[model samples]
Target: MCRVPPLSPRTSPTISWKNCINESDPPNLQCGSIQVPVDYGKPHCEHFNLTFARIKTNGISCLGSLVYNPGGPGGAGSDVVFAHVLKGISVWSAELLAQYDLIGLDPRGTGLSNPMKCDPTIWNQRVSMTPQNEEEFNQLVENNKAFSESCRNLTGPIFDFMDTASAAKDMDMVRRALQEDKLNFLGQSYDSQLGSRYAGLFPQNIGRMVLDGITDVSLPGTAQLLIKSNTYESTLNEFFKWCNTTIQCALINQDAPGIFDKLIGTANTNPIPAPGCSPLSEHPCRSDATSEEILTEVQLGLIGFNGTVSFTGWPALSLGILEASKGNATLLSRPIITTPTSSDFSFLGVACFDCKATSISHIDLLLKRQMTSTLSPHTLGATQTYQAQAQCTGWAAPATNTNHALKPKKIAQLPELLLVNSLWDPSTSIVWANLLREQLLSARLVLRKGAGHTSYFAAGETSRAMDGFLLRGELPEQGTTFKS
Candidate 1:
């Protein structure tokens, strides 16, 4: 059994919880900030405020705080709580709504916390994450290095410490500040890694933890990339399946797959013109749509499905593909890039700091591209892994936490964990859920066989099962499956 480490005495600056309730804020919402050490190795050296929002239950009985982290490593938990939970409280079960106070904390260096900033121009550059040749690859490396240096110069030494381990410790601090002996957490996507690390570090303090859209930290960079690419390819295949069967799809019975392939070929040789895009626009609305841009849009559209009865952007994607096939790129180039915010920097900073990158040699890059193409020939291996590799090629900061290699050592005293994953999830793969389950011996796996990213928010059976477990300590039988 792995022994949980004892928490150090509270040497960080004290934080006071203030009631910042406003008309726009969620009902029964209380907003506040807590001070935590920037570097846990030196708790008293320097501190920053971690902002949080809580929606206290109005029921007669209270069952402590349920802290939530909505992935992104850069995602603002407070924003999720306000926008999703509080706004859609009716979707939740009465038992869950009555019991736990939903708390969302913006991890250090994100959102209302001491957010790190960098030059927006660096991000605005129209560089392809998937470089086609050596020259483009070298340019990507230089651009990535410049971006990292900009972050280091702007954020200083603090940039080196925004790893997941630091965020996990900040979670513990939030628990202590809320005067709770145990923490109940719901972490999605990359935040699942955060929650898993927290559970490994402080098993004794865990109450009820649910990790949805499971991320397997055990996989090597290359393996991770391959798995993600293959999974995305599967999702694309699923989309094709839908297009062939469903009348709603504009490309139904039109050789959708062949059309998509020809569209990519055309964009590669001659970039399609997008008259709808404007140079003066704040968005990344380009005047032309490259093959890479169309691929990215399709990938994003597939990932954004809500697991509802109908897919969200399938029609749009079908129309976009049809339009691109006809030489009109107007729909395909509709501002894929949103305005860059602090979260953009935080995402890159935290991700690069948490995971060690493989060597960026030309041979290695070529091998990776070859592997990705082989595994996912249709998609051409374009996934988040490629993006991470491109951005972190010359990352300036060394990793503060090497906890990504943590295996699930049997800890008998740990609380039961609930893991959820959508079978066709575009971002996090179902294989990751299985890998994580193997490590977490006490965990119950809920497989939602449907489309979408995370399962809980869609108010499906997965959400019901999660609510049952979180509120009433009701664990579904091991290996249970739910249909979304």
Candidate 2:
């Protein structure tokens, strides 16, 4: 077991909880902030105030705090708690809700915390993430550099300190302030990396941790890009298959995949016009849907939620494709031009700080393009991977946390971890779960057989298993599978 120094009154930040629960909040919900060192490595340096919310247990018996992160690296933990958990409390398992107080901490540089900021004009520009030629690629590189500089200038040196390791340290400090000897964490998507790093740093402090929508930090940068590209291609194929059987599908009895490809080709040659789009002075709608916009919508649709609506079902995606094929771009362009908020900017800042390359190289670009083509040819290998590469090409901020791959040292007293994933998660991919399982010394893998991103939010068997583990310390049999 790892040793922790006794918490001194002078070292600890003040903890004061206020009744900031909104009308939408569930009973017993409370919110507060705690001041922490801006750079943990230099505790005497400047400090940042981190915000968090807690949903107190309803049962007579309390089982400490359960900290939650809804991925994005930039996703607001408090927002997730308020919107998904508290709002839909009925959907969650009563046992879990009654046992532990749900704690949501907006990590340093996200949400209620001192959020990272950048030039809105630079971020709002419609830049093609997937560049076709050398000139376009150069422009992308330049744009990324400019954006990175803007963030650095506005956010200051704190931009460099927003890495996952720093955030993980903040979590431990939160645990100390909560007066808990151990941490119970549920991290989704990119937050999985945060939780895993926390485990590596504080193994004995782990209580019952669940990492859903697994992200394998072990893979090399190039391999990571290929896996994501291939997974998205497979999920897109699954969408086509669903359309084949569902009569309500807009492209039913028609060649869905073929139509999608043809539409992309047409958009590549000439962007499809959206007549309904208002002038730029009035709204941010694009006059035409570029090929990049089409691909982006398809990618978002695969995640099962287009930003405007709750869930973008397969039928909705088919309808968008159908409209695009007929030379109308309204449906495809709507989600693309939706002006990004501060959270969106924070997402880029945190993500780039965590995983982006320090400097651009021609060899790296060529290798990425080749890998995307070879691994995910059907989808043209240009989605999130291409977007990340284009946007992070000339990222200037040096990574404060260099250890990307997490391998927790074996601690005999550490609690077994629970890992959950969908068999066909478009964003994270199932292979990541398999790889992560192997890396973690004590972990149980539960597979949710379905589409979409994370499984716990669905409140299905996978969710039940997760809740059981978090609430009662029950571990499902290794390699267990659940139908969503």
- Cα deviation in Å at residue 280, candidate 1? 3.6
Please list the residue runs of candidate 1 whose C-alpha ends up more than 4 Å from where it truly belongs after superposition. 1-15, 19-27, 85-94, 282-284, 306-312, 334-342, 407-410
Candidate 2 lDDT, 53-126, residue by residue in tens:
88788888899989988887688888866764555534346788788888977988887787887787787676
In model 2, what is the error at residue 331, expressed in angstroms? 2.5
- Residue pairs that clash (backbone atoms under 3 angstroms), model 1: none
How many backbone clashes does every candidate have?
Answer: 0, 0
Q: What would the TM-scores of all predictions be? A: 0.91, 0.90
What are the Cα lDDT values of the candidates?
0.78, 0.76
* Candidate 1: worst-modelled 10 consecutive residues by lDDT: 2-11
lDDT of 1 by residue, 23-102 (tens): 56545878878767777777646666789877779888899889887787688877766664555634346677689888
What lDDT score goes with residue 250 in model 2?
Answer: 89
